[model samples]
Target: MIGDPKTGTLQHARIEGVGHEGLSCSAVDGRPLEFALLDPTTGEIVEHGPHVAQEAFNVARQVYRNVMKGQGWLRVLSEPAPLTARKAA
Candidate 1:
C-alpha cells in the first residue's frame, strides 16, 4: 500500500518489474495509483503505474510492504505533479 502525499489516501499496487534503473507497477483499483513509482537504484520515487483489479493490487501492496521492510527504507509514497495547460508566452 502507498499513501498519497497530498491527501493522505492509500492505495494498493503490484510491482510488475524492478531494477537498478527503475520500477514498474499496476494499481489494484482499476484506476492508476496516484503515487510515484520508486527507483531502487536511486532510492527515489519517479513514476506511476497502470491499473489492475482491486484484489490483485491489494495483494501486491502487501507483498511490497514486506519487501520494503527488509530494505530498511521509509514506506511512503510521493505524489505526482498535476498536468496543466500551458499558454504561449
Candidate 2:
C-alpha cells in the first residue's frame, strides 16, 4: 500500500439520495469508497456506500497513513509492506 499521504485515503464525494420519488435528499456521510478499505483481502464494499457502512473510514485512515509516508495510491485489496526492511539472517 505504498502511496502518497495526500488522497491516500481514497476519499469519495458525498452520496445524495433521491427522496419521495424525486425529491432531493441530504448527502450521505463518510464518502462512498471507504467501506472497501476495511477488508484488505477482498476489499469488497461490505455495503453500497462508505458512509452508510463503517468500513470506509477505515480505508480512509489507511489512505491517509500511506500518503503521509510518501506513498502512492493503493488499493485496499493490495498488500501493505513494512516501512523499513530488516537485514536477512
Candidate 3:
C-alpha cells in the first residue's frame, strides 16, 4: 500500500508470483503476481496485470521514494549540519 502524503489518497496493491493466482484476489500471477492498482477511496481498479508488468511496479515504487526524498521526508540523519558564524565563535 502506498499513499499521496499531500492528498491523503491511498492505493492498494498485491503482488504474488506465478501459481499463486486466486490466493489473494489475484486473477493471474504470471510475471510476478496478480498486480492491481486500486484506488481505495473509490474502490476502483486503476490498472491491472498481465498488462501492468513488473517494470511498472518498479517504476511506481521508485517514484514514491523520489517523492519522499523531494519532500524532505527521507533525509539522512547522519549528515552534519551547516556551521554558522556564531557557532564558529
Candidate 4:
C-alpha cells in the first residue's frame, strides 16, 4: 500500500504494482505527497516488508524518493511556484 490507495491517488504513477510476481503492491503519489494533504485527505506510506531480502525496502525507498523529487514536487515547493499556465484563446 502506497500513497492514498483508497483515494485512488496511487493511479497517478501508472505503477499498477511493484515487487516480484508473488509480492506486488500499488505505487502511490500525488500533490499531497509533496505536502498538500492534511490528515483527512492524506495517507501515510505503508511498508509491506521486513525486507527479508536484501536491498528490498532500501531500493524502493530510493526510487520512490527520486520520483517525488524529480516530479512537480521540486517546482511546486519553490518560492512563487512554477506551474502557472499560459492560457491561449
Best by lDDT: 3
Error of 4 at 53 (Å): 3.2
TM-scores of the models, in the given order?
A: 0.22, 0.28, 0.28, 0.22
Error of 3 at 54 (Å): 1.8
Candidate 2 clashes: the total is: 12
- For 36-66, candidate 4 gives per-residue lDDT tens digits of 2124445654332423222344445556676
Q: What is the lDDT of residue 78 in candidate 3?
A: 28
For candidate 3, write residues 6-67 as lDDT tens digits: 53232443433343232222223322345566999997998776545554544445565767
lDDT of 2 by residue, 1-89 (tens): 34643432323354332322221222246432322223567776444443333344455566767877878866554333455642332
* Error in Å for residue 60 of model 1: 0.6
RMSD of each: 14.0, 13.9, 16.5, 15.1
Q: Which stretches of candidate 2 lie over 4 Å from their true place?
A: 1-52, 78-89
lDDT of 1 by residue, 61-88 (tens): 6566768679644344433335553232
Candidate 2 lands at a TM-score of: 0.28
Badly placed stretches (over 4 Å) of model 3 are 1-33, 60-89
Compared with the true structure, the alpha-carbon lDDT of candidate 4 equals 0.37
